[model samples]
Target chain A: MGPEVMPLLENRNDIDLVLWQQDCACDRKWFLENVQGATAIIVMFGDKVDSELFEAAGPQLRVVSTMSVGYDHIDVKEISKRKIKLGYTPDVLSDAVADICIMLALMAGRNARESMAVVNEGKWPNYSWAPFLFCGRQLSSTATSQRTVGFIGFGRIAHATLARLIPFGYTHCLYLANPSSAPATARDAALAAQHHLQSVQRVDADTLAATSDVVFVLAPGGAATEHLVGARFLRRMKPTAVLVNASRGTLVDSDALATALRERWIWGAGLDVVTGEPNIAADHPLVKEPRCVVVPHIGSATIETRIDMATLAVNNALAAIAGEAMPASVEF
Target chain B: MGPEVMPLLENRNDIDLVLWQQDCACDRKWFLENVQGATAIIVMFGDKVDSELFEAAGPQLRVVSTMSVGYDHIDVKEISKRKIKLGYTPDVLSDAVADICIMLALMAGRNARESMAVVNEGKWPNYSWAPFLFCGRQLSSTATSQRTVGFIGFGRIAHATLARLIPFGYTHCLYLANPSSAPATARDAALAAQHHLQSVQRVDADTLAATSDVVFVLAPGGAATEHLVGARFLRRMKPTAVLVNASRGTLVDSDALATALRERWIWGAGLDVVTGEPNIAADHPLVKEPRCVVVPHIGSATIETRIDMATLAVNNALAAIAGEAMPASVEF
Candidate 1:
């Protein structure tokens, strides 16, 4: 938690807090034992709030607040049955995550990994200037090539990313939304008008993969969306296109992505999340790929955004303990 | 030159081309000996053009075209005195260079160098989640904290960078220009209106350094402006602020910046150009700083941009040799 959040919880005159003061996440065993007799417990994205956790906390558990937008770690079905109010931070982190999306897109397309290596590994002295050396794909549009940006999911964060791209001269946007939701023509037109884009169209997955100069996987991660950017999608993409994923790890297949880069199916990839993360091997295929730029999941790891998320989580916990509504909450 | 440039020169039956077929820059000794009777000579940024070169070409050098925006490598005064038309690429690369300015800002503020190391160096397995781990400064605005961006020179490239920053929620823009030119309030207001900014104010160097959250050095490089961002200017800056230099290295003193980062006068720096570049030692002070992120001076090194520059340079040479006005020319 942020330094401010601890004081916010401890300074409340009406509340008594059991704080896990370490920098790392609280251990599962420590959480289960210390959570007893608590009215509310604050958790992180790595924690699981399940039947086991509910039984450990007893009937006194009234609220479970998490300092993240997604609650995949928690068992929503069990939490709903127990009627525990779930508080989470969603809108607070859109700008931070969206910022990383552009950073990754620009970095990957600009060959940042290779260029930095030249400077960092002491090869810059020998690697002098050339006209086209170290050149990569251009993100912005020119008269000859108008840029087209595609999204796997079009939510709030995606919208924020699109707004940033408009000034870069991306005139067209093609997105793949959940098929269950109808394509709203009015909303699409409004979005186009708001950003002054040439076109904003809903497209099928294959078309989105083939047409976009840059493809962003911003979909939610779950069983339904697992391996959504697998071989078929990679194969359909333009050879010059770049891929960026500031979203979930499960939505992309590592093996497929590695093959795509190796075979030149796509130009490059900028990934914030990977499958089996937090224990990713040094020799992971995607990690070894020259064209792939990967970072630890730092989509919302800005100082301001992290503090805001922590503050919101603490506030939600305090509000739910007083039987009031959370500042932000999940339906479950 | 790009692959296409060689073909563009070779396919033209009307022109006889002397091509240096190599990946690296042409050797100066070889260039002088072979240019005995050339009407036009195309050069890279590393080449110098002066009286000796004009004498070697036997006064047939009517045009000296360079594949860059900056003509610091060429002797513009002598070229103008000798009635030689000088051609350079300017507007073609503004977008590309502006793209890098934002890239550096995002990379420095978000600690991309550190975060990538966590994954790339195999530290991710043990570097588990913590609230503030790897957290750096935020670039965008929130309801509580609006953003202020500053520039050292408010030219075309600076304006392009400002356009990119608007969507990042920067509300105010402060800038320092050549003091000889009078401030235009009408122009400032017009710029503010065009970008929907809260304010676009002209200020002194110290005020720009002290008030800005991020300061970009975008001025031209020369003796008059050398070391403009020296010790005194760095001292007045916000501790949380970031400094980005994409314009020219002569504008900033590298030693002063090194001390600033070490002593926490500023949070970090992102640099594309450094003083005494292309031969920067491994133990160079700025390169040794953990808070600094540096790349080779590749501001206009995008495939599309470089090709445009090269194409423009070639066309300018051809037109000037034919006694027609060059496509893009420098008056001095």
Candidate 2:
């Protein structure tokens, strides 16, 4: 359980509490033994909720609330089979994640990794500023031209990011939404007008890869979306374009991205989540690239947002305990 | 001379070119000897333009154009005394610099320095993601509260930054404009209505320091403005606030800022320029702080922006040579 969620649940007299106090992921052995008869469980993103966990919990588990926006770590099929209600924090973290998305996009385009190293490694004294030293791709639109931004997922977080990008003078937006959804050209037109963009086109992945100056991957992480941004898509991207990933790590292929950056297929990449995060080392292919700016899965990490997510998760659990609807329920 | 500017001037058969071919700052002996008979001189920030250089030029110089925004390195008083036209690239690079201002603010507030170190230093393997492990202050406004932004100098770049910030839901703006400018409450109200912000007010430095959640120093660099953000100013700031400097490094006192961060008087600082830059080493106090994010003066170092600046500098010099008004001239 998150430390913030402890106080919110500790004051309740009607329930007995079993808290995992470690800052890291709960120990597997302890979690399996302690979760034996839990009526409801609060899980972090690091915890995998699967058949084994469900089998340990027995049949009385009525809720599994996660303190995160992504439920990819949870086994939705298993939860549904057990008729357990799934609750996850979503809307509360959209703004924070969107802020990081814009931050990463700017960092990637501006060559932040190399520049920061220059300052932190004591290279500035000998580093002379040429007319074009450390020159990078600019994010804001110039007076003469506008920039276009593309998104792989046009959901709540993407919309929030779009709102922030409009003021940077990005006049065109391209997005690849759910492939199965019906095309909404009229809706696209309305969105463009509303955001003051010249156009918001619903394009195929190839066109988006080729056309956008900045490509954002904000889609879900699942089997279907795994490796959505692979070699084929990357090779089609503009040589000077930037790719930002603030969503699920599995959506982007790390190997393909590393190669693309190494060979200059794409200018740079900024990632908040990686395929096997918390295990990404200095020698990791992507981290080794000077152009790739990687942070450890901090997409929704903000003081206020984290507290809100914890409170919401706790609320979802408490609501379930009271035989009430979870505040942010997943209809699986 | 800048490499880009050389090509722009080389093809012009009307003018003779004496180029400094080195990528670094020109040697003192070469510069003084070569500049003796020159009718015009173009300079970068590293090249100081004081009375000594004017004496060396034998009073024949008609124009002093710099390929930068800040002119503190130039002796503006001497230029005015000689009636020499001073040209600079201003409006062209505002968007780029403003983009960096926003980028720095986000980075400073998001614990970018330490978080990035963890990934770059091979420490992520043992790093655990707690609820508040790397959580930082959010830049965007939450549903419950709107954030306030303050500016030390409300000029072209600050306004551009403000335009970009509005989409992040910054509802209030406080600024310390030119001290001698008359009170313009009506102007402030109009500015607020134009941006759809709740309020925009010209306030004293003390009030600005005390009120803002983010403070941006965008004023010019000179004796009058040097150390404008000193110990007292920083002490007045909120403990959770962020400070960003993109304009002139001399405007901030580095030692005071370092102490502020060390003592937890402020949350973080993001700086593009620093006093005695190109000399700041790894042991520099600000760089030593994990909360401070310093880049080596890359505010306007974007490919397109630099080209535009170089081209503009060349054009300004040629226009002055032709006895026409410079495209961008600094008036006394």
Candidate 3:
């Protein structure tokens, strides 16, 4: 167990006698010593909480709360068979994530980074004052007429993203969600009324991939959604379109996006989450792409949002240990 | 006089005369020598057009066009007396200038420069994410609510500026034009109604300077408006207010504005036309002020807008030469 999870373990007053493991190593010594005589476990994504770990818990473990949204770190089916509860925070960080989404959208579309580099390099005088020198698209201000704002997934964060776009002159919203979902939920109906939009639908990946002026990737990032916006999707986007990603980075193949931006198939991109965490290198294909804007995974980094998330996670853990209904329990 | 006006000279067939002479020393001398038997004379802001220049051209001088909104440089009294038709391009550049007005409003109110500097300087890592880090007052977008958007003039540009504010959450409009003139002519009443705004009224400079969340100087520049937004007006402005000057340079007292921005008396400011023009030094008082965003006179620099302005200017020159009414003429 690493030191990161040790603090949570020592501070457990309401969550009684739990197993916790942080990734210090990939072998049995760390895992076996960590889960002894525990009723619940808090694991990070790096830890392997498979059948072996579950069997080692000896049927005493009743709840598993991962510190991330994705539960691929744990075997959910086995836990469901054992009737163990599950918990994850989903909508709690929507506002924070939406903030990042907008930040990326504005930064990438406006070419802020490149402009700043020019200012830093003290080349203002050398640059000609041509009308279109750095006049990037101004995301749907009142002064503009046509706009096409798109979403890869119509989820809580995407709804929040739309709220921000309303003020910026976003009139059109195209969505590609799961085909089995209802055609019009209350949120979709409300958004339609608010924006005077045409319709919200679960279109094929190709339609969503093609028509949007600013395509936002807000879909789940797992095996099913991996590389959803690959070479074909990039080809479908307009030459002037911008792509924003605040969801799982795995949904986009970085190489494809980099190629699109470099070849001017797409205008630019803003990404808060990358395919791998903290492993972005100088020579990363996307990093070298001029139109690709990247930020450290700070989607849920706003102070207000982070506090709310922490408070909710603490309350859920306490409620689960006390045998009460968790306020935001995630069902497997 | 300078190379900047070479484009005007090369297209002499289209432009019958030039009006602005502020920097036309060498060029004016050369034009007078090479442009013999010309049908008209062009004057600028600083040069005085009197009976002598008209007499020099004799019967050939048929028109006098000033390259400015104000006719102070033309000696309009003499032009009217001479019965030589006058030409000025007004209303054509209003929307473009108004766009700059709103751009300044947003940039100042949102602290764009400061926020971007923070991000560009790598300060985000050292600072803990906070809720109100760069929050500023959002402009009122709804018309039903009365968040007053005031103006120093009630002309075409001011009306256009109000239209730009509709999407930015601006609801109300108050203006302080020349008290001697009516708030708005009957022609613009319908336009005012479209914005859900009341008729413009004349307010004292102090009162107009005090109440506006964003005060725009869209009035013509010359002796009358010079120092209109001086220290006295700055003293009356709200601490959270933003000031935008796109009409002319001398309307605002640069020293007073710099002091206001530096001392935090006013929130921020955006200036397209600075007082001294190209002579502004790197360490000029206004340039050093962090709260000020100075763009180098790019009011009508948009692709769609500049072509229109140049076309109108060319047409005005031709009309004055052909003894036809200029489509849009500025009067004294």
Candidate 4:
């Protein structure tokens, strides 16, 4: 739901394509009007790829590529039954998301909004210069010459974000990854060690949330992880903690996050991905809260990332139709 | 003139010293009106303390205690010839001034204003997120685990500011102090070595301005150092350089600074002192220019620093009148 990805179809015709750019709720009238003549349909989260639509599209339909990682929009059972190819863009935007996470962390910790309000209010004369007028949190160094950074997820973006924080005087990193199978957990441990981070034994989510100075939510967002940072998880956080979310909107409940900010459950929250995209009004509890800094979902919107994504999406469609290996085809 | 140092008091107690505090300028008018019976005057800068005012106050005036570092407003020659004791506040606000210098440097280099403006203006969503949206020059880290910080003046606040920048990544410091004094240069070099700075060399102003990534103007302010950062010195700077000034308003020419910022003479400027202090309105040339940030002189405005200054000023008056050592008298 960022910008229309149809700019991907501007002129390249090496591959025959069927563009069904439906971004709304799935309906029989909408599906029959456009998707019936397509070889493949590029749909987002809201569109349902039910049996009726698939049958309506008929024999020419060769692929169903959901723009998002989650494919709840598509009835995957029917797609697998027909053995159609699928594609999604992930990992590519991790760096962008990570960058936003850090931006939010710094902005929230510094109380940038309130500080700016001071200057704008024309109260500079009455306000005496002080050693610490708006001193909030130090992002980098500590009195001990060592600072600890923590992440709630150990995904690609989380690692990249960790790399950025290292230069800011972070010497220790704590991470909480979803409990993995034996082989995957071993890989995770090795990755953590490679990054010079200790692979502390996986603990409950509450422990990770409590101990981290900065907790980043970069996990997969679905029913299994809904409202992961509710009141209980929030209460466990350090008083000076900063929470960042660049993953999915549903991973956090906005009401819970707002309450935490209001009651000082945590120092601040930087949210790039809120529970509902674009629908968050200024009056939304979190938006109105001083400490909670909300940014519109722009995690993967960098020029380099966007161009790479477009090229990959195009290649994925072409390769799927030509019966070739797609660069980043979704396994699920 | 800063709000702290502007009033010229005429009477020993016109505005009821214990209550009904007035602006420094108002206090100056009150002092002028009531000076005929006054024995001493507790004054700040910007009030004309000349032969006329002295003659008006008559021969009873024994001392003049200025609540500021600079005494350009008072005729030192007249005071010396008259044998009246003079006192001015110094050494108190050095740390506070240093803090503001560092804050401005960090804020400018990070493009904090522009990014915050974008968010405030609601252009964040249309503008895609990127890894380098506001990637500005990081002042602290450079040259292999250590940063080399150079100052144009090795005064008290410059040393204090250097100390603050040390933990952020500065390991080497270079300085240019009073050109005529070799002993002053040696003292600074020894201090730098004590702080673990690689070297502190006394270079000419031109060389100091050129080689430094962040050049601070912390020298005494007066006619002797007017327009120090003119066309030639700015031309020699790196494109990523930042200039911080917390010393005096007259030290930098506002027009030249605006031109430098517009022409990219150096990366940006963090100015707590300008050509004119509070007179810098919205349409001021520097205010109109991008990358040139200006703050009304609020150095030493912290609660602790202010209380110390007020107490010191009061103590200086008491000591001068009672024939004891003035706590921090500015001896010429």
What are the lDDT figures for the candidates, one per model? Answer: 0.89, 0.91, 0.66, 0.65
Off by over 4 Å in 2: A1-5, B1-5, B184-186
B1-332: candidate 1 lDDT, tens digit per residue? 86777777888899888987787878888888988799899999888888888888887778999998888888878898898899998888888898888989988888888888788887899986899988888888865898999999999889989999999999999999998988789999999999999999999998999999999999888887899999999999998899999988899999999999999999899999998887787688998887898989988888999999999999989899889988899985
Candidate 2: share of reference interface contacts reproduced: 0.81
TM per prediction: 0.98, 0.98, 0.62, 0.59
Candidate 1 TM-score versus the reference: 0.98
C-alpha lDDT (0 to 100) for residue B69 of candidate 1: 82
Task: Answer with 2 or 3, whichever has the higher lDDT.
Answer: 2
Task: Supply candidate 2's per-residue lDDT for B121.
Answer: 91
Q: Write the per-residue lDDT of candidate 1 for residues A1-332, one digit (tens) a residue.
A: 76566789878899988888788878999999999898999999988889999999999899999999878888989999999999999888999998899999989888888888788877888975688888888888765778899999999899999999998999899999988988789999999999998999999999999999998888888787899899999999999899999888999999999999999999899999999898887799998887899989999998899989999999999999998978998984
Instruction: Indicate the DockQ of the complex predicted as candidate 1.
Output: 0.76
Q: Which residue pairs does candidate 4 place in steric collision?
A: A129-B301, A129-B302, A130-B301, A130-B302, B7-B24, B8-B28, B9-B31, B10-B31
Question: In model 4, what is the error at residue B107, expressed in angstroms?
Answer: 0.8
Clashes of each: 0, 0, 14, 8
The digit string of per-residue lDDT tens for model 2 on B1-332 reads: 45555777888898888888878787767888888978889989888888889989877799999999889989988889998899999999999899999899999999998999999998988876678888889988888878999999988898889888998889999999888878879878888998899999888899999999999999999998999999999999999899999988999999999999999999999999999998998999999999999999999999989989998998899999999999998889
> For model 2, how big is the CA root-mean-square deviation?
1.4
TM-score of chain B of 3: 0.82
List model 4 lDDT by residue over B1-332, tens digit each: 22442242224453323221443353545566677755557666656677777887788777887767768778888888777788877777665566566667765665555644455455554443232344456654522335566676677778777766654556667676665755565676677776667777777767777777788888777777787777777888777888888787777777778888898878888776677555555567776655765656655554445545665666677677677988887666
Interface RMSD of 3: 8.6
